[model samples]
Target: MVARSTCQPRRGFCFFMSAKRPQSGLLAGRAPTVSADAYHWRMRYQRIDLNLLVALDVLLAERNVTRAAERMHITQSAMSGVLARLRDHFGDQLLVPVGRTMQLTPRAESLVEPVRDIVLRVDSALGTQPDFDPATAQRHFVVIASDYVSRVMLAEVVRRVAAMAPGLTFDIRPTSEIMLGELEQGRADFLITPAHLTAADHPQEVLFDDTYKVLACLQHPDLAGGVTVEQYRSLGHVVYQNERGINPWFEQWYANQYGSTRRVEVITHSFTLIPRFIVGTRRITTIQTRLANQFAQSLAVQIFDPPMETPRLTEVLQWHRLRETDAAVQWVREQIVAGSHAMPPI
Candidate 1:
């Protein structure tokens, strides 16, 4: 399920946690707890709404309701209402109009620099900085990963994270065309992607290198001991495509090398769906060997080495350069890398 909370940016950070899979490790089934220091801090600020600090900073900086509203993505009237609330809260006419222009009052002027400093301090405190502690952190992580990675690795990742920090939650989103935007805008904490899809600026490390295997239903008649290049291209294929009509990386590479293409009988957004789709059909899909082995355990899927030579699939863990120094993010990256290494190779 997804968790949602509301407040202004930086003042009160909010996110959703969607881990449909079972939690792993020793911390499974236990309720998350807040540390005593965090509990006491919450109590001290029980009546204080920190969101107003953001409005105050903007109001003082711009000294114009419309501009401040534009900056805050709120309406001018709403900004005026925030000013009114600030006036009541601070007992000061924070802004005074001098003809057509609004000027900060003496009290507002006094608060201007301090408000900036306080907001900065609070943001630094709330951020996943270099001093982050996973043991007691109430952190939320957003990761964009392919279905294969999510199925083959996310469970283990969650297990490790839960074992260390029960209070942390993960929001794993599917890989999409706009994935880079999510990373650039700080919406996603990390992106698990193949080397071909990696962005230039993001700091990344290879999580694992996997080999591809041809997966088909066990009852497939066309596939016997091994697949030939001709049979592979002639057989109906199920490809993973985030966008309609686009093929998977392997298929594109095959077409480039052989100057021919497979008969794509089905194109689905998820690699996990290929197993179900290929069942009782002649359709064959190329998938990471690790994932193919996983699906073969439950599904009646047969794995085979493809006739054509293929390169090892290197999946990388990438984060926005801005978060490279973040201790929590760094730790999460390390744990994921460790989890990938700990997995038995296929």
Candidate 2:
């Protein structure tokens, strides 16, 4: 056996303490074993109430103590009590009054997104109901959206709804104004909007994506492939308007990027009528393929290669979870899905 003082470490510096083990020579005795209690020593702690996290999230969103308390269906005094408990647990004032209003302290600000995510996770795991059937269903579904999706996608959604559930009905609500009402009443069923809508915009899902193509009356023979900046400017067109709002974002975007807009002859919200209008005039408007094709069937319009730099089209489907399981609503959604699929993939 080697002398204890002269033994070398396995690697690195020999500054560490040498741990002891039973000696190499026929063991005189076995090493003493440790007790299980040593591994179970207690530390200072108290059980935390998780429901407080939900309250804190609501408080942060409302900001006003009274309003926050109302949203949680709790008394203002109780809200203050919870706020105090939050401050004590965090060891700082989570919110402090500045002038006449409360402002989130640094710690409260950091907890905002995390609290929201946690609340959503808990609800997702434990909150949803388990049954839906359309046969005996009685519910009105409201959908708010752009006219373009209506012409292209909603026609299919409508057709499917009519075919599958003749008893149940839908209120194809137009305009974005109904978003809050639909969400508040739990009435909005399926929505198709860009996926980037704000959280306040409502709960939604990305249904599908589409792209832009130039819609011209087949008779408009002066353009093909890329409609040059000058040629685009020279075309007479029907712009869309909703009580003064410009047509689709594509129109404004194209004008800004190409230096000038097409000469305007009419502004109408009736997307179906645009093709009819263009059919008889020298007007050409760039529109989505959905409406363009719908128009092409009757309006004699030609789909041209989109002028190189147009935004990718996205036809996203969104819906509220309240009626997410309703059978009739689901049939409508499926019809939309199928109808959308029927169109040749572009």
Candidate 3:
């Protein structure tokens, strides 16, 4: 005789196990027992293919068969076949066409977060090393940071690490509103941004704090002596605006305090470009002191203390919660923090 039981370790997942009864002596008519480890391995290997989960993740993310194929490095037809299998297994049309675009079915939408979590956990478990040797480790890290932070902090961090770990590489991407999502999805290893912008779910540390400064052309007649509050507000301004038209931290503060009293002469998407627009013009811009000083050294711009008190800008370094124990990640984070400490006082 055989005894059968079902196990469910996670929601939406079920496993069945069968054990034969012992036939003799003291153990007769008793069912054999299966260890938890044995049950897990049997369910994983015999019932599911992890590769399919990976494919499903990619498919849901892309939502387009051709693009999913391109991302997975498989043929379009192959991706379609994988989709068919996933649909059969899940008993739902995971991706259905809505006009020309594809949309996730309700079931597929429900699986996105859990599936990503499982994939990241598995990757972390398999990729963790007992120890890390920076000198010989071949590793690549992806960082998301604003251009201002990149220039003032991350540039120095990379330079220092290059000398210590020649085999390590970095891919730095610009900071965006979706940066936290990138970190959660394992697409970014580090995020350097203002403290307020960081996600509460992650672990973060204060990299540095900087004050705001008013920047104007060196030859601007009104600001030659010094800028007064009236002059600061009356002057045309060059400001930073992201692609999504969201204002920077200082801009938001300015709006609340002064409310459109200052005229914006120019709006740019780049933080570093703010000085370029200010130079050779009467326009003025408020920027972080660290970046403003760097620009003042080479450009014909004069830095002044803001006429009105502004909030301090605190830049922070954040990483995924799951990577807290990852040795390589911790090593790189230490290097970055050390670099921040070594920077000249603003």
Candidate 4:
């Protein structure tokens, strides 16, 4: 049987149908799908140049061929050639000129995230080392962690990294609702969070276990003879509030054991600022024991255990499961564990 071209266009491409009568056999009915898939797959590999992906990444970022060329340190004509090839391979005008600037088409917009992800994975694969040499490795590690971890663990971890890996640097970002997205997208290398909050699918290691302590001004009269549930509930409390969602383990536990009637007088995001706000005020807050002790040593604050039984805060260092085999990321996780162990146990 001969094949004839269809008048309709599908995804800017044509479809063909056999002129012969429909086959009664099941094998013949499914043959076209498999054949078409294999044909398109072969054609895709033949037309796609991996180098064009690099150019596409830059083009998406800059939205201009000249700017992309400048960043890639290539001639404008060379960049234009790459773009032309990409447009032909993709069967879409990826970028369209809109007066003074260029705009991404709908298809281009859809390709942005996946293309960036592929380019990032490729870069990471090429850049990863077989054996990380901490003594001389020049790398920057990005960490997303809560304020408590930043104060209690990250400071020591960063200090050790600086001493051992002098050429390396660390960027600590505050914990946010999008932290998991950042980790999955390779925007951040490590994440520090409590075990309850850590996703089970990721590669993670427990850094340390911590207990909570109630922090209050040293001269607060109500807290002189150990705090009880009644006193704690009556006093104003300070808690960290961020878009990352609530992390009120203590409050939740208290509500289960006691009741959900405690007053939250102040809500601030910074852990350091919590102490300043509580000083000379009747407001009290629950913090990790390590951080509370550190603050107690310098600030005029008193630390006490919570009245009811509370769960242990098991802090863990996590990375994307896909990056578990990467030597550099493994080394960073090891350094974090070592740093946590070296510190005095909380």
Candidate 5:
């Protein structure tokens, strides 16, 4: 029927009414729902019935209400009601029981692939995708190293960062704990250390290689230029130890080379205090070159060439496999390499 213009301001606006009389429309004897206004008002608020898809999918897969409900973690009665709704919606007996078990009809079988495709499409469109940006990243990085290496290059690292990337920062922690798990589990970003860790521990990079040197008090006439294998053996010695004794190989090599044990008169695990011991006395000390240069400016100890040859020490840069791909970490490695090249020989 034509709508009467209720007294609204718009001239063309008028509500429309369903022309169908009772007993002939979609709801049989119910009142009509018509016009864009009435249709939208009803359509916008209608609750979707998701049970149709659930029951249809389960029925096609299981072909039995009780089994489908068990698969869905619901009771059989609930599934029975769902199956009844599905049958009514499709206007077909989708599943038929024969003898002992149920089977899907042709119509139900045809719906399987299409239903699965629709569910997959919906999932793909709704799933989240993650992105990582370096400039705005506020991530904590932990590096493990000995106090020896830390003292040598850490200041340069910090200063270099301020000039290059003011936004990035790092923390270097020293510990002798087994670190493979720490790196594997994302606890530490990298490690620069002297000890030879096993292969299972972490990925690694060779930072720089170094050899031994003798730093003796310049006042000692015996060590004016360099100490002999004989003089080095006779002179009082200072050894840096990680725990109890210095590396057994270093000790063995010292003995094997000079046919006498090193005169390790004083032993301290702390390298920081070694300079004070060598500076005031006529004693001689053997140490790594980086420590020698660091002490050169402050102490009267003169760094001289070693009288005997020894194996070079490999100072490695190590990290958890996870940090290997990270840009900030890569930059840190590059800076370390650059700064290490400038370090004096041992």
Candidate 6:
């Protein structure tokens, strides 16, 4: 005999409770009354396969069934079947066709962060070991940082760690507007960014602080006597603009401090390219002193004190709060901190 649940229908799987007959008893065939809430809660996950969560996470990230299948190392038809099952279980088409590409449905979009978080938590829980032996443990770390940070700090950290941990590998991704989102989603093991831009919820430590410096071509006539506030405003500027068309911290600060007084002649996405754009031109750019000093080594650019005082750029290393106690993460953090301390003074 079976008892029906009085609970309202929900989106996920449903289960019914059954009662077995007792041996030769009066109430043998009679079904027992079960608390609807208790039964529902107990059987909630019984019918659902936890593996589908992994599939759903990949499907939602790629949005394209073919691409998702490629990432999951399954055939396209198998991924289609998974998608069909997901749609049926969730009662929604998670990814729908939009013109030539697929677009995430509203429900799917809302689930992106939570699903990624769940998958990451599960991976971390299962993959973490009681002890981390960097020399023998095989691990790949993902770091998200700007080229400036990579050139100035992370490159050295990687070199230093590589000699000690031969089995360890690294994937350094460029910083973007969605960098914090990537960190939150656990795609990045570490995020090196400006202190002010770091997520407030995460644990972060200052890597280093650098003041701004003016960069110009060595042959520039106007800056021969050093730059003045009036000359700085009048000179053509080569500025750094990220791929997302967002201005860097100093550019934003300058605009706020002096309005639109400086004229932007060239805008490039790469910080390393800023000096190249200023060469042979009357243009000047304001960049971090550490990076300016680096470019001065190879490029024919001279660095000068900023015509006006600017806020110091404090680069910071950050990680997900959940990873604070991760042994491997802690080990890497220690190495990075030590590397930062060993950097040459600007």
Query: What's the TM-score of each model vs. the native?
Result: 0.66, 0.55, 0.84, 0.72, 0.55, 0.84
For candidate 6, write residues 250-343 as lDDT tens digits: 9889889989999889999888788989889899999999999999999999999987889878899998766766677778889999989988
Q: What is candidate 5's lDDT per residue for 91-135, written digit by digit as tens?
A: 788888888998778877866655433322222222211333444
Q: Which stretches of candidate 4 lie over 4 Å from their true place?
A: 1-113, 251-259
The sequence of per-residue lDDT tens digits that candidate 3 reaches over residues 234-338 is 899999988899998999999998898998889999998888788778899999999999998999998999888999999999987767777778889999999
Q: After superposition, how far is residue 255 of candidate 3 from its true place, in Å?
A: 1.3
What's model 2's lDDT at 345? Answer: 63
lDDT of 2 by residue, 1-346 (tens): 1112224221111111123321111101112232233212111112334446656666776677898666444568877887888788668788889999999988788766655444443433332333435455434455677777777777666766665555555557665644544443333456666554423544454556766666776766676554666666678877776655744667766767765556877778865667777775667777776677667676677877655678866666665443344344455567767767776666
Q: Kindly indicate the candidate among 2 and 4 with the higher TM-score.
A: 4
Q: What lDDT is reached at residue 9 by model 4? A: 18
Off by over 4 Å in 6: 1-46
Pairs with backbone N, CA or C atoms under 3 Å apart (clashes), candidate 2: 134-327, 134-328, 191-318, 207-317, 210-313
Query: Which one is best on lDDT?
Result: 3
Cα TM-score of candidate 5: 0.55
The sequence of per-residue lDDT tens digits that candidate 1 reaches over residues 28-129 is: 111224445445544653465666776777788779989877655556777788888889978899999899999999989877655654443344344434
CA lDDT of every candidate: 0.71, 0.57, 0.76, 0.70, 0.58, 0.75
- Lowest-lDDT window of 10 residues in candidate 2? 21-30
TM-score of candidate 4 relative to the true fold: 0.72
lDDT of 1: 0.71
lDDT of candidate 6 at residue 26, scale 0 to 100: 11
**lDDT score of residue 71 within candidate 4:** 52
Root mean square deviation (Cα) for candidate 2: 20.7
**In model 2, how large is the Cα lDDT of residue 291?**
70
Task: Report how far residue 55 has shifted in candidate 2, in Å.
Answer: 28
Q: Model 2, which residues run further than 4 Å from truth?
A: 1-130, 177-181, 184-187, 197-201, 224-226, 244-246, 321-335
Per-residue lDDT for 197 in model 4?
75
